[model samples]
Each structure stands twice: as C-alpha cells, then as structure tokens.
Target chain A: MSGLIKSSLARKVVMALSGLFLVVFLTQHFVINFTSVIAPETFNEWSHFMGYNPLVQFVLQPILIGGVVIHFIMGFVLEIQNKKARGIGYAKYNGGANAPWTSRNMIITGAVVLAFLGLHFYDFWVHEMDYKYVSGLAEDPTRYHEETVEKFAPFWRTVIYVISFVLLSMHLWHGFNSSFQTMGVNNKYSPAIKTITKLFSVIIPLGFIFIALYHHLNPITH
Target chain B: MKLFLKIWRQANANSKGKFTEYTLDGIEGDMSFLEMLDILNEDLIAKSEEPVEFDHDCREGICGMCSLQINGEPHGPDRGVTTCQLHMRRFSDGDTIVIEPFRAKAFPVIKDLIVDRSAFDRIQQAGGYVSVNTSGNTIDANAIPIEKENADNAFNAAACIGCGACVAACKNASAMLFTSAKVSQYALLPQGQVEATDRVMSMVKQMDLEGFGNCTNTGACEVECPKGISLENIARMNREYYAASIKG
Candidate 1:
C-alpha cells in the first residue's frame, strides 16, 4: 500500500474519486435550484424544505464538505509531488500543443472555485444555515427567505457568481475527464466519458449562471 | 560579437555560489550557445580559474544533458530547441546575459548549472518502463499490429528526454506535463497497457514525493519546451489516472 501510495496511479485515483464525488454534489445542488426558475414559490418552498430535511442537515452536509476538502487537498498534494519529481521547469523538448490551459491551471481554477465556495457559503449557506440557526429560525427556513433573495439581488454578487462559475466550468472541463482517467476507467468508456465531461463542463456552469442572472435581473420582491 | 556574461560559479554543490562577470570579445556570431560558454571557459582556464561546471553530452541535442537558465529563461529564449542548439547570433553584441542554475527543489545544483536530474530517472523506474524485459523475444515485434495513430502518438510521447526545463519555466513548478507524457506513451501503446495503471500511479506518486510545486497552467512549460510535447499528453495521463483509480 505504501508503494501504491507513492505511485502516480494512486494519486490520480484519489483525484478522480474526490472529483467525481464533488461533481455528483454539484449536479444535485443544481437540480434542486432549477426548481426556482420553474415557479418562484415552489423554488422557495423547496429551498426551505431542503434545509429542514433532517438527514441532509446532519449527516450529508458533513459528507459534502468533506468531499470538497479531500478533492482539493489531494489535487494540490499530487501537484506538489509532481513538481518535486520533475524540476523547477519541465523539459520543453517533448511538450507541444498537447497541453491545454485547464490541465495546467487545475490549481488556479481549483483555488478560484475554493474562494468562490467561501463566498458561496457566506451568501447562501450562512443565511440558509448559520443565520437560520442563530436567529432561532432553524425550525422554519422561510423566515430567512428574504436573506437569500437580498444576497443574490446584488448585481456584483451575480457577476462574481458568473465569473466563478466560469472558472468552475474550466475546472470541471479538465477535472471531469481527468477524474475518469485518474480512477483507471479509461477503456472503451473513455470516449463517452470525454463527451460527458465536455458537456457537463458547459452545462453545469451555465445552470449556475442562469440561476444567478435570473435572480439578479428579476429582483424578487418580498 | 562582444557580450557580457553574468555566469554562476561554484566549486561544488556544498560550496557557496555566485555570479561572476566576464566579457568576451570578437566571438563569431554563428557560434552555438555552448560554444559561447566554451569560449568563456577557455578564457577562464587561461587565467588559471576554474571553468564553469555545466552539463553537456552529445551537444547535437539528443542526450538531454544540457540545461541552463539563460537570462531567466530555460534553454535560452529559443523555442523548440535545447540550450546546446541555441546560437550566439540570437544575442546582440554587448548584451548582458544572466546565467543561473535550474531552480527547482527537486533539481538542486550539483555544480554551477549542472542539476541532478536523476529524479526523473527514479520516476521512470517507479513505473515508466515497459514491464516486459528484453529477454527471449516475446514473439515477433510485429506480433501485435498497433494502430498507426496509437503507434505514432506513442512515439511522440516517448520523445521526452527527461530534461527539467518544464519545471523551471512553470510558475508552480508542477511536473504533470512530464509525468503525463511518460504515462500517455504507454497508455497509447498496446505493449504498455499491461502496466499502464501501475506505471502512471507509481510515477505520479514518486513525482509528488520529490518536493516540487503544483501545476498552475500558465502554459510557460509548453511555450519553452524544446521538443514541443503536447499538453494533450497531460490530459491523456489525467484520463488514464482516472481509470486507474477506479480499478484500484
């Protein structure tokens, strides 16, 4: 296991598992929010109901957070290890147009996504969870419904979300495919996986962007 | 052509290193980059001084031994060529050239510009090589008719000489490009598929243990690399790695 631990294959495995887990989380989160555009009232109720779900509130949130932590930690750790194995600069002779921006910028995009997570929690989760708990509205999340609207209502916040989601798209573009490869799944399924990776890279971020823009443009009146 | 060279000088890895200034006069502009260094060394030897210690073998550029940070850029400023391939004609007369050893935690200075690139070899040993030994011929070489595309890509991927310039040119010093190239070579070839997962996982792990920084995707590595290895190989490795993780 130690020998395996020291191998690149294992490190990639860690990256893939963690990354795919987060992708699943992102899709679920997106699907839940798509309800808002269908009908604002339903969206609000759904959001409120999601907050009150006992299993998700207690058991799942920790797991979701843990996924984020592990995905990011393993990525950076593997990157550092790769650097040490090479040198300050990699050999230029063999490298060509083969390198894409995202593969090189995984850390940058990941860092961007990480920072976005902080803002994300500060805006949505803080109000949806932390403030709800502090204001004695834990039993009723709708009391803080205005908080959710007010946060997304800011044009700048919406812009930040768009840019961050763009970064997230870039991250996911490389990460989605990379996750599959890292997990040793690059067989006949590679083509299908690559296609899905590209599609999700665009679709998921677009989903988030649409939600943010709709909220900002149509500022929900309390 | 006349030029000012701020070359790094050190007796050995344990000794203190510093930049020493030297001016060369009447050097032919057509001289290769290494020839310019040779001229400088000749001048120093005449003065009874130690010549700068840098790595070079088969200066024709196939050996992958020559490496230097010329004016803060690896292999000088020329794209798609090694330091040995660079010509003095690229520099104007009286230009100030700053020379430094390749800066990488994994590539510590052995003497002056010579770096210990043995880490790359160790990584290859971790799983870069084909598992099948060259004992009694395992059937004929053509027993397996690998697809032309895969064969070509494998050849392209195998072009990596293990020079450490990508690490130096990269902002974070990540070696994903190099490790990926090695992994993709085997991943693309049928002969390498048997050890593909193990090769990529082990090599990448060894790379991480070496104390280098993470990849930040500035494209500097791609831009400065002499052989022009594609960033696509990195993606291939990522894909290969993803598959390996699930199997394990």
Candidate 2:
C-alpha cells in the first residue's frame, strides 16, 4: 500500500520480508548447487527440471528476480534516507567502539554482493537464457554438470567467486539475524534463533566457497 | 591532570560551527567532566574571551540535561552514566578530549554543544500516553494485577531520560531506541492496551516525520545509552507497530 511505503517501519518490514524470502531461495539454490559436487547426475536432473519446468521458470524465477530488485531498491532508499538523517557528519565517529564493522558497513558488503550478483547472472542466468531461448538448443540434461564445472575452470573467475562469497558471508552475518529482530521476534527462543542465524550465515557461504573450489580443482576431464 | 580540549563552537543555529582548542592544567581527577569545563570557562572569562557553551542542569545524571559527545562517544566513553556523572579520571593526563554536540538533522544545534531535542518532545506528544480518568474517579491502583516480569520490563523501559544519547551514538542518528523505550513503558501495562493500536501508529508516524533514520539493528544505541535501555524495547516496539498495522 502507498501508506505502507510512506512509513519507515513499514519500509523496514518490506526489507525484512523480502530479505527472508531471498534467504529461502538461497537455501534451495545452495542445496542444488551442493549436489553438483556430491552427485553430478542428481545435479543435472534437478537443474534440468528447474530450467525447463513451467512453474519454476515462469512463476518462481520472475518472483525471485522481483524480490532481488525490491530488496536492493529498498536498501538504497533506506540508505539515502539514513544519510539525510545525519545532516552534519561527526568530526570523529568511532563507530567500532559500539557496533561491529559488519553491522555498520552493510552497504559496503551489500554493494559487493550486488556486484557479484551481476557477474553471477551473466555467468549462469544469461548463459541459460541464451542457450534455451536465443539459440533454441535441444534439451541436454547431462550438459549442465559439464557446463557448471567448466565455468569454474578459470582461476580468475574462481577467485572472484570465492571473494564474493566472503563478502556475502559478512553481509549475512549481520542481515540474517537482523531480519528476525526487525520482525519483532523477541522471546525465550531468541538466543537460539540468533545462534541458528549466525551458524547459517557462516555455513552456507562456506559451503558455496567449498563448491566453487571443488569444481575449480576437479574440472571435468576430457 | 592537564588536558587538551577541542570543543565545538557556534554562534547560533544559523551560524557555521568550528572546533576551538583549549589547553587547561591543574585539574583534579576527581572533578567531573563538567567541572573541568567550568574551569575552562573561568579561564576564558578572566581572559575576556567567549566561553564554551554547553547544556547542564541538576549536575546529576537523572536530569538528562547535559549532553556531550566526548572523544567521539556519548558521555565520554563511560558506561551507564551521563556527561555530568563522568569524571576526569577516565582520561589520562595530557589527553585531548573532543567535545561536540549531538548531531542529527532532527536535533539541530541551538548553540555549541546544545542541540534542540524538541523533536523528541514532538514524538512523545504524538501518542506516548495512556488515557485514564484523572477527575477524582481514578481506578484503584490494586484493582488490576500485572505480571512481575512485565512490570520489571516496563520499569526498565521507563528508565530512559530522553537524553538523546542514543541518537548521538547511532551511526544513522536513528531515534528508534528512545522512541521504543517510551512505547514499551506503556505497551507492557494493562492501561495502555485501550489505545495501544493508535499509540504505536501515530508515534511511529511522528517519528518518521521527524526525519529520524530507520533502525538497522546495529545495537549501537543500546551500547551507548546512559540509562542502559535494552534493545528489547525496540524489538517490542516493532512487534507493537506490526500488530497495529495488521489490526488496521
């Protein structure tokens, strides 16, 4: 609603909800990507299904894209408004004394992650679109495994991917738990929730890094 | 103890400000931060120079009248104490202390080290209250029982003195903590339930209108708050506001 957009708290609720939605998507994406290293056949099968299925390609993909766009746009809106709130900057702001760097520098981490998203889309999404839509190629279920493995074959790409995942880790380190707080989730289980969010922030990014390295090291043999 | 002081000086709200440095000697460690400032003022008065202006009243921590960003921190790097309660002993001899007013667009500087905090009063006026009969027909205090934990939490939330330190401490100059404390103090009690829905809605709207930044859950406000107001108040306010929006 227009009224919701006008309220600062409502805007944050939008950020929290959209961010949580992306987290769900990230979890599923991580699971499927992990299968590429553990079970190539399973990865190919699932990737094929996701790529071709009308429900996923038509419905979920557009929604996922919308979520990403909304999150980033709202993030920028909030950042600009926040900057305006402090009309005059402090001469010496020792922000480190109270808040963590990850928490304070979310925009920096988020920008890095956004840049990585551009590269990630170019590497995979754009390629997939070109393959399926532009070129009108016949379906090759097994091609996914080889194609994914080969993408990481380049040392430079792998290094970039690894660095992006590190930045993503820092972004999630603050954001994942922060979403819950924004949603007003304070209770006896809050401590446990925080622990789980922290763990997920670390483990998921580490998992992605591991997958990237694994493929880079063990590219498909000729 | 001798110290170097860099204090922000401004002629008025419209005038540009700059930090003017002063060196003072023979200050006792037992003297409060304000006492040291008083000594500096005395020297400036004798020299026929403009004295550094700051806000202070009651000289006690409870008034919430004194505000100073000492050494880039609210209340001079002390925990759970206002500027008036901070002693010079916290600093080493020959230390350079930087004193500036709390900076926020919503809190404009009225003079050196005194920003207008009427923005908070406006937020409070928006709805930080509960309607009750005060016409000699008030309900009995013991008529209704409240849970002990809720009472304790409410009391803790009420500890906020509206010092604007949380605003000074937040990187974004967000007033979420201060506003949340006021909301929580009432939202926890039975009396507040009658207008709970309207209270949160209008207060939050007013807060946004005041041009305060949104909360990012950085927890800096909690760390720097002299009253030790918990971040739980903010979480509670978020819950309150969400519930109100849904109810509408």
Candidate 3:
C-alpha cells in the first residue's frame, strides 16, 4: 500500500477517485438544494432530516469533509510536483495551441472552487453547527426554508455564489470525464460517457445558479 | 525567405545557456527547417564562429533522434512532422523563429539545442520488454491469435519514437504518453501476458522515480506527437497499472 501510494500513477488514481466521489456528493447536494426553488416545504423537511439525523450528521458529513480535504491537499501536492517537473521554464510555451483552456487550467478552476467552498461552509455549515450544537436550539423543521432563503438575500453574496458556480462549471467540464479516463475507462461506452459528463458539467452548475438567483429575487417579505 | 532565429546556446551540461540571435536570407521555401539551420551553420563555420548544436540523425521523421521546440511548438508549426521534416515555407519572410531544447527535469539540457534524454532509456530499461527464452525454445509470434483491433492498437502504441515531444508539449512535462504507449504495446500482446503485472508495476515505479510530472490528461501530448499517437493508449495503461496494483 505504501508502494502504491508512492507511485505517480497511484497518486493520480487517488485524485480521480476522490474527485469522482465529490462529483457524486455534488449531484446529491444539487438535488437537495434545487428543492428550495420549487418546493420549499420539501426542502425544509429534507434539510431538517439531514440536520438532525445521526447517520448524516455523525457519519456521512465527516466522510464528505474528509473527501474535500483529501481532494484539495492532493491537488496542491500534485500541482507543486508538476511545476517542479518543468525545471527550467519555457521562454514561450503555446499551451493554448494544443489543449483547451479548461483542460490546461484545472488548477485555476479548482482553486476558485476551493475558495467558494470556504464561503459556502461559512454561510451554511457554520450556521447549522451554531444553531444546532452551540446554541442548542430546539428542532424546528420549517425553519430551514427561511434560513436558506435569507442567506441568499444579499446581492453581493448572490453574485459571488453565481460567479463561483461558473468556475465550478469550468472545473467539472474537464474533471468529470477526466476522472473516468484516469480510471482507465476506454471502451465503446466512452463516447456516451463523454457526452453525458459534458452535459452534466453545464447543467448542474446552471441549476445551482438558478437556485441562488431564485432565492435572491424571491426572498420572504414577511 | 529571410528568417530571424533565436537559438539557445550552451557550452556543456554544467554551463549556463542563452538565446543567440542570427539572421539568414535567401532561404528557399523548399528547404527543410533543419536545412536552413545547416546553411546558418555553414555561414558560422566560414566566419570561424561556433555553430549552434541541435540533435538530428535520419533527417527523416522515422528516427526519434531529432528534437526541437520550434516557435513554442514541438517540431515547428506544422502538424505531424519533426523539425527535420518541417519546411521553411511554414514561416513567412522576416518571421522570427525561436528554437530551444525540450525542457523537463528528466531531460536536462546537454548543450545548445540538445537535451539528455537518457532518462527515457532508463524508464525503458525498467520493464519495457517481454521475457522469452531464445535457446531453440522461442514460440512463434504468429502462433498466438490477437484481435484485429488489439493488434492495430498495439502497433500504433509501438510507433512512439521516444522523442520527448510529449514531455515538451505538456505543461507539466509529464511523460505519461510515452510511458503509456510503451506499456500498451506489450500489454495488448499475448507474449506480454506473463509479466504484464510486474512490467507495469516496475515501469511505473521507475517513471515516478525519474521525477517526471503526473499526467493530468490535458491531451497536449497526443496533439504534439509526430506519429499522432492516440490518447487511448494512456487510458489502457491506466487500466493496466491499476489492475496490476490490485493483483499485487
């Protein structure tokens, strides 16, 4: 296992597997978040269950955090090593001539996504922790709807969320199918997988953007 | 055509390098890029000055001996050709061409436009082979039947010239394409089955030890390869490596 972890190929496999895990988490998170736009009651119930349920709070949430930490740490480690690989810089490297911006600039996109996660955790996770664990607030299933909507009421926050989503879209554009490639998935289904990943990259972020905008524009007036 | 050239110059591996500028006039469109360089060298030798040094052998694209990062692209602006095959017509009159050796931690600049690519040889030495007895006990290669697609792909993977263009073109200087091509060639053949697990594990271990960057799958290597080696070989190697690790 130590030998496996030491190999560059193994390191890449770790990145790919961790990244794919995050993608799965993102899809689930998107599904839950989208409910706030169309079904506030459903959103409140689901959010309440996730907040109070021992399985989610104690088990899955920690695993999710672990995934995020591993992904980012490994990303930084790989990026630094990769930089060292090109010991002397090229006087003029035309990287855009061959590869797409999305493929070549994953580090940039991934960094932005990491920054966005900081803000996201601050806005929601921190608040949830304070509300439930720190203050020891009594369970209120309906409170989730108002709390979520109010967080997006600020125009600046909404704009930041939207911009972050765009960068997240760019990250997924290369990362989604790339994970499959790293897993050594090359077969008859590859073309179909590529198409699906491309579509998902665009659509999921758009859905998140829509949720952010919808809450910002339709804040409760009472 | 007349061209202004910015060529890298260095005395030895331990010495510093810099771009030395030169101008050549009356270059014909039919002259290959290397031929133009030959004329410049002739002029320099006539003046009793040291001519620029670059690597080349066959002058044809077959031998991977030729390597040059011309005008920011490996093997010049033309696609699917080496510097020796790149023609002067690719550039216009008065165009400035920048020539530098392939840059990678694994490929140190030896002198001028020549880089020491013996790192590739070391990686090859690690496990890039099929172990077969030769003392009147070798099985006929034709005895094992391979699928048409697998055979074609193995042949394609075998075409990699070990020219470090994939490393030069990659932003990370990753040698995944070259290594993967080598792995895939043997991985697809029946003779390679016995040692497939060990071959992959050993080669990948050697590749990592060489200090080459990890592959990010940017696909630059595929685009810049003179032979147009496909990215599928990389995916195949990834699969092979993972399976090998699991087997171990």
Candidate 4:
C-alpha cells in the first residue's frame, strides 16, 4: 500500500478517483440547487432532510469534506512536483504551441475554484453551522427557501457566484477529460467521452449560474 | 539563407549555462539541421574557440542519439523527425533559432547542448526487461502465439529509442511516454507475463524516485516524440500499474 501510494502513476490514480468523486458531488449539489426554481417545496424538504439527518451530517458530510481536501491537496502536490521536475525553464517556452490554455493553467484554474469554494462554504455551510451550534436557531427548516434567496439577493454576491461558476467551467473543461485519460480509459469510446465531458463541463456550470441568477432576479417576497 | 543561433553553453553538470549567440550565412536549404550546426562548429574551430558540444551518432533518426531542443520545439518545428533528420528548409531566411539541451531535473546539462540522460538508463535498468531462461530447454518464441493486435502494439511500443525529447517537451518534464513505451513493450508479450506486475510497479517506482514529474495528460510528449509514439502507451502503462496495485 505504501509502495503504491509512493508511485507517480498510483498517486495520479488517486487524483483521478478523487476528482471523479467531486464531479458526482457537484452534480448532486447542482441538481438540488436547481430544484429551488422548479419545485421549491421539494427543494426545502430535501434540504431539511439533509440538514437534520445525523447520518448525512456526521458520516457523509465529513467524507465529502475529506474528498474536497484530498482533491485540493493532491492538485497542489502534483503542481509542486511538476515545477521541481523542471529545474530551469526554457528562456522562450511557447507552451501554447502544444497544449491548450486550460490544460496548462490547471493549477491557476484550480486556485480560482478553491477561492470560490471558500466563499461557498462561508455563505452556506458556515451559516448553517452558526445557526445550529452557535446562534441556537437550529429547529427552523421553514426558512430554507427564504435564506437561499436572501443569500443571492445581494448584487455583488450574485456577480461573484456567476464569475466563480465561469471559472469552475474552465477548470472542469480540462479536468473532466483529463481524469478519464489519467485513469487509462483511452480507446475507441474516448472521443465520445471527451465530447460528453466537454458538454457537461459547460452545461453544469451554466446551470449553477442560472440558479444564482434566478434567485437574484426574483427574490422571494416576505 | 542566413540564421542567427542562440545555443546553450555549459561546462559541466554543476556549472551554470547560458545561450551564446552566433551568426551563420550562406546556409543551404538542403542542409540537415545537424549539418548546419556542423558548419558552425567548423567555423568556431578555425577561430580557435571550443566547438558547441551536442550529441549525434547516426545523423539519421533511427539511433535517437541526437537530442536537441530547436526553437522551443524538440527536434525543430517539423513533427515526427529527430534533430539529425530535420532540414534547414524548415526555417525561413533571417530566422533566429534557439538551441538548448533537454532540460529536466533528471537530465542535467553535461556541457553545451548535451545533457546526461543516464537517468533514463537507470529507470530502464530497474525492471524494463523480462527475465528469460537461457537454459538448453528454452521454449521457442514463435511457439507462444500472440494475438495480432497485441503483437503489433508490442512492436509499436518497442519502437522508442530512449531519446530524452519526451522529457524536454513535457511541461512537467514527465517521462511518462518513454517509461510507458518500455512498460507496454514487455507487458504485451507472452514472455513478459511472469513479471508483468512486478515490472510495472518497480519501473514506475524508479521513475518517480528519479525526480521526474507526474503526467498531467497534456499530450505534449506524444506530439513532440520523434517516432510519433502514441499517448495510448501511457494509458496502457497506467492500467498495468493500477492492476498491479489492486492485486497486492
């Protein structure tokens, strides 16, 4: 096990697996968020169940957090290793000659995504925690829709969410197909995978941005 | 044609290196890239200056002995050809060419335009070969019937000449293409079945231990490879490595 973790290929397999895990999490989160516009009661009910369930809060949430931490840390670890591998760079390196901008700037896009995650956690997760553990208003599940609308009501906050989603799109554009390649899934079906990944990368982030915009443009009247 | 050249100059592995500029005129379009360099060296020799040191043996693409990064592209702008095979016609008149040795932490500059690529040799030495019985009762290689596709794939993988261009072209200086080529070559063959698991594990371990970077799937190494080695080999190697880990 130790030997496997130490190998470069094995380490990459870890990154790919963790990345795929995050993608699934993102899809679930996006679907839940999208439900607020289509079916408010169902969205609120699902939110209530997730928030109040001890299994989800204690077991799954912690694992999700661990997954995020692992994915983020692995990105940094790989970036640092890659930088050190090239001791001295070419005086005139035309990286664009061979690779796409998103592929080459994965570390940069990843940093952008990380910063956005910080804002996301502060906006939703921290507020939930404070309401329950700190402020002692834990029993209120009725205000779930109102609270979500209120969060998106601020113009600057909406703008930030939109921009973050755009950056996330860029990050995923390279990441989705890259994870597949890393897992050694290249074959006749790979072109189809790349096409689907490209579509998902664009559409999912666009969906998130649309949800934020919908809430911002039509805040619930009290 | 006249060309301005900026060639990397280093005294040794530990010494500092920088690009030294030279001007060459009356270069013909028919001259190979290495031949142009030969003319420059001959001129330097007449002036009693040390000729720029670079590696080349066959002056053909087969040996993979010739290694140089010409104008930010490994083996020059043209694809699928080594430096020795690249012609002067690839560049227009008055073009400035930057020549440098393959740069990587694992491939330290030994001198002008020359890097010590024995790191590749070490990785190969780790587990690149199948341990075959040389006793009198050895089975004939032809008897073990391999599928046509696997046999072709093995032959393709075996085409790699251990040139360090893949390392030079990779943004992370990853040697995945080179290492994978070796791994896939043996892994696809029947003789290599006995040690497939151990070979993949040890080769990848040695690759990481040698200070090479991780593969990011940018596909630069495959694009820059002189032999046009496919990115599929890297995928195959990854699959083999994952299988080895799962079994253990």
Which one wins on DockQ?
Answer: 3
Error of 1 at B128 (Å): 5.1
lDDT of 2 by residue, B188-207 (tens): 99988998988888888899
Better of 2 and 3 by DockQ: 3
CA displacement after TM-score superposition, residue A16 of candidate 4 (Å): 0.8
Q: Candidate 3 - CAPRI tier?
A: medium
After the best TM-score superposition of candidate 3, give how far the Cα of residue B223 lies from its true spot, in angstroms: 0.6
TM-score of chain B of each: 0.96, 0.98, 0.98, 0.97
TM-score of chain A of each: 0.89, 0.98, 0.98, 0.97
| Model 3 vs. true fold: TM | 0.98
After superposition, the stretches of candidate 4 with alpha carbons farther than 4 Å from their true spots are B133-139
**What lDDT is reached at residue B121 by model 4?**
94
Off by over 4 Å in 3: B135-138
Q: Give per-residue CA lDDT, model 4, range A38-68, as digits (tens).
A: 9888889889989989999999999999998
Ranking by TM-score: 2, 3, 4, 1
All candidates: TM-score = 0.74, 0.98, 0.98, 0.96
**Against the unseen true structure, what C-alpha lDDT does each candidate score?**
0.77, 0.92, 0.91, 0.90
Tell me the interface RMSD of model 2, in angstroms: 1.3
> Residue-wise lDDT of candidate 2 within A44-157, one digit each (tens)?
999999999999999999999999999999999889999999999999888989999999998899999999999999999999999999999999999999999999999999
Model 3 chain A lowest lDDT segment of ten: A1-10
- lDDT winner, 2 or 3: 2
Per-residue lDDT of A142-216 in model 1, one digit per residue for the tens?
A: 543445556787778888899999999999988888665444454668789889989999998999899878777
Q: Which digits, one per residue and each the tens of the lDDT, describe model 3 over residues A1-222? A: 555767888888889999999999999999999999889999999999999899999999999999999999999999999999999998978898899999999999999999999999999999999988899988899999899999999999999999999999999988999899888887898899889988999999999999999999998999
Tens-digit lDDT string for candidate 4 (B71-94): 888888888899999999888999
